[model samples]
Target: MTEPSSTPHATAPGASASSQTAASQSAADETPASQADFRASARRTFAIEEAAIAALESHLDDDFDRACQLMLATKGRVIVTGMGKSGHVASKIAATLASTGTPAFFVHPGEASHGDLGMITPADVVLALSNSGETAEVTALLPLLKRMGTPLVSMTGKPGSTLARDAEAHLDTSVAQEACPLNLAPTASTTAALVMGDALAVALLEARGFTAEEFALSHPGGSLGRRLLLRVQDVMHHGDALPRVALGSPLRDALLEITRQGMGFTCVIDDDDHLVGVYTDGDLRRTLDQHGDLRALKVDDVMTRGGKTVRASMLAAEAVRIMEENRISVLVVCDEDEHPIGAIHMHGLLASGVI
Candidate 1:
């Protein structure tokens, strides 16, 4: 009939529009279900990895101690080496160890076979990582490491693997299941390895008695470094910026000094220029309440004696602690002889990032 219409009847203008609209509605309906599947998948992955890390706690044993002792006693750095995803985890472990007072650095196993092996010395302890323990690049280095007399520490999912057997210490980072739905990805295994690395770093850190100051020295560019290294003298107001008034100076003069220096307080000094007392905004209010005239009072009459003071050489963080303990905002910096040298306000510590 009519040579059979070239276009299918469903492709007619009105039918085509309706069909496209139906397709759009169908896609819109599937979107929420797709999003729900994605979220459920993420939750399952997190749960599996969390369990993997928790399970590692029971695996910590004598080998873990030996690993730490070997690293601690090494005359040289800890050379961390791994391949593939394990290599990424190894690199991070090296960084964490280095920052926490353990000297360490990462070397790729593939590169090690290509002359990077020279980076490892007999004095250094080699920490090798391979989830499979049979990673060709990593297992290839075992004989070389042994020949060099380098002590080897291996982290692997299989305790009986070649890398583990050859290592002086083996850390089992095996997980019960892979977080990947296909059971092919390194998700849970890598998490276990990372947590084990952190455990080693922290154990070594404690054994070495690594103080916050020591940690800060390794991280001089971070906030902890600023808090540990910044001295009171570095942020204190010195010379003319110091608010000081003589012991017998009028209360009015002391208030003027405080306002002039904008330090909220003024140091009342003796004739010898040693700090004798402190007159603050708190003193002014108290004086107004107890006295008839502010001008008639002397700074010594309202000054608080034996006010808290810090040495100029003290850490700004320590100064913050003192201010916090006393519930005050300002502190006068003094010399060894208790002579007022400078003054610090809470704002100074805040600006210096010491608080």
Candidate 2:
């Protein structure tokens, strides 16, 4: 999980600490009759920003389609480059692209000028981000990037700026004005850029028909990957570690097997090694309530017949779901003939990061 850090500079109206200062200043600068003026100013900024983003919906034209096609055809990763705040958004965009299907990585424009440009190659596509379309570090590398025959896709606010004009395709992320009360900081423009990046990534992801399993491949270190990739067989107890009792075994012997395996249940199989039934703690409790001698009864008489089972190849997440739907804690893994192969408990799912 990301560390919980306060949004020191976030412009979220009443949700960010920075807005407190803006609110206090607004209160002091306005009179009773000028309340409407303050509201009108703030409302206008929001309206302008909204209109700017609305404009982008129509601007997602053939250029956007060409950019997606270029990215999909790449034999190498997409190298996202930008300066300042655009660099932060660029890093997130790269991560989103990588997780969705298009492999990508971020290379800071300043770092590129210093020596990191070696990360780019002829097979790679360079995605340059600049709100004003005039960032110095970004513009300086355009000629060199173009010379290498690397296709350029620029996301910028100004369509006529050098970065946009020089790119093979440009995505417009322009905003009418900043959401900043001073109308100077990057607020609306940054949000617009971030949204555009998400739109592009998701569009490509859909076009590629990216699956959840494919997304998990790119995030093998995370919990989602563990849930999707880990199978029931990988976390199940096997051999003597499983609690099992032959048919006609005494209930006491079945209870002993459960205690020995520490799985809270025992499988009862016939002479042929096919599952006959299962004896859980709940079954034991109900059996004991019948006033019969615990040691006198056989597992075949007390076990729950044809209990719930799962296949060894099923995903751990699916196993968790099946267990949940049945209100059970463990499932018997079975083979084609309904013979017990392995057993898994809820705790095993948690241990395997499938919870």
Candidate 3:
């Protein structure tokens, strides 16, 4: 019987992901502007949006400070509301604020006019985004907001418009022109609004002195959370799974321990159960190169004396740094007395998303 060789096909291992992606992209491009230089058009859009965001610096005034102070002093949540494209940017801003220490959530202007207006309170602060500052759905909520005595902070292109005039503070997010050729789409205007929203959230974050650990608490399930919160002991192999052998043990015993634990290395411990050194696969190769008498070799002679170690309480990210700086793939987790309680390998760090 003969095993067939894999041929170069779209789904085969021989066809790499890059090749598949290129094929799909070329096949799926059905643009009407195929004759136009797409990359050059993209560059122009970037330039226009960049100018819009940069223009905001000149527009900053006491209104920006008033907006920040209003949100900071609010006892209840920051209620973010918008319509159409502005709604999408408002949703993201609310999420950023909530995660960064300022509690906030988004409410659609149309929905707010319905029954969701009941969700707002006198202690709450309302952040409204409308490029025209006169969006019917948004402006409809202004009278109710004033009646309830809820402070309004607005980001609008038109400073003289109704929404801006009603707000306690107005952030001018006006842009010179739309990046769209038709000059109707909310291209540069939306970018300016989003950047202004981020400025507000980050300003609030610094005012609150938000810490990374607190940020991790808000995002407890992602790779970022693991990087910020996971300790060396949480990811290291411990107890019986920890690979180790006596310091004076024969090199073959260290080899057996490494193979049994599948850690590619083994800790060498003295009779008092304290780690004295470590023997790795690299050490094995070096030992074989330097010593012809394999039978006479001991772990004590071949091992790296007092090999690099980390405390169990150390951060997993710090452990990764040590591994990178030392050019090693593994580290022994030692106690105050330098006794090996556990071990960590590069594979474990990668698997735990701490790498």
Identify the candidate with maximal lDDT.
Answer: 3
Where does the lowest 10-residue lDDT sum fall in candidate 1? 1-10
Residues forming the 10-long window of minimal summed lDDT in candidate 2: 8-17
Stretches > 4 Å off in candidate 2: 1-51
TM-score of 3: 0.86
Across 1-355, the per-residue lDDT of candidate 3 in tens digits comes to: 9867545453575457778898888866755676579999999999999999999999999999999999999999999999999999999999999999999999999998879999999999999999999999999999999999999999999999999999999999999999998989999999999999999999999999999999998997887888899999999999999999997898889999999999999998899999889999999899889999988888898899998999999999999999999999999999999989999999999999986
Candidate 1 structure quality by residue, lDDT tens digits, 226-278: 98888898999999999999989888899889899898899989989899999
- TM-score (C-alpha, index-matched) for candidate 2: 0.85
Off by over 4 Å in 1: 1-26, 32-39, 285-298
TM-score for all predictions? 0.84, 0.85, 0.86
1 against 3, candidate with superior TM-score: 3
Local distance difference test, per candidate? 0.92, 0.90, 0.94
| lDDT of the structure predicted as candidate 2 | 0.90
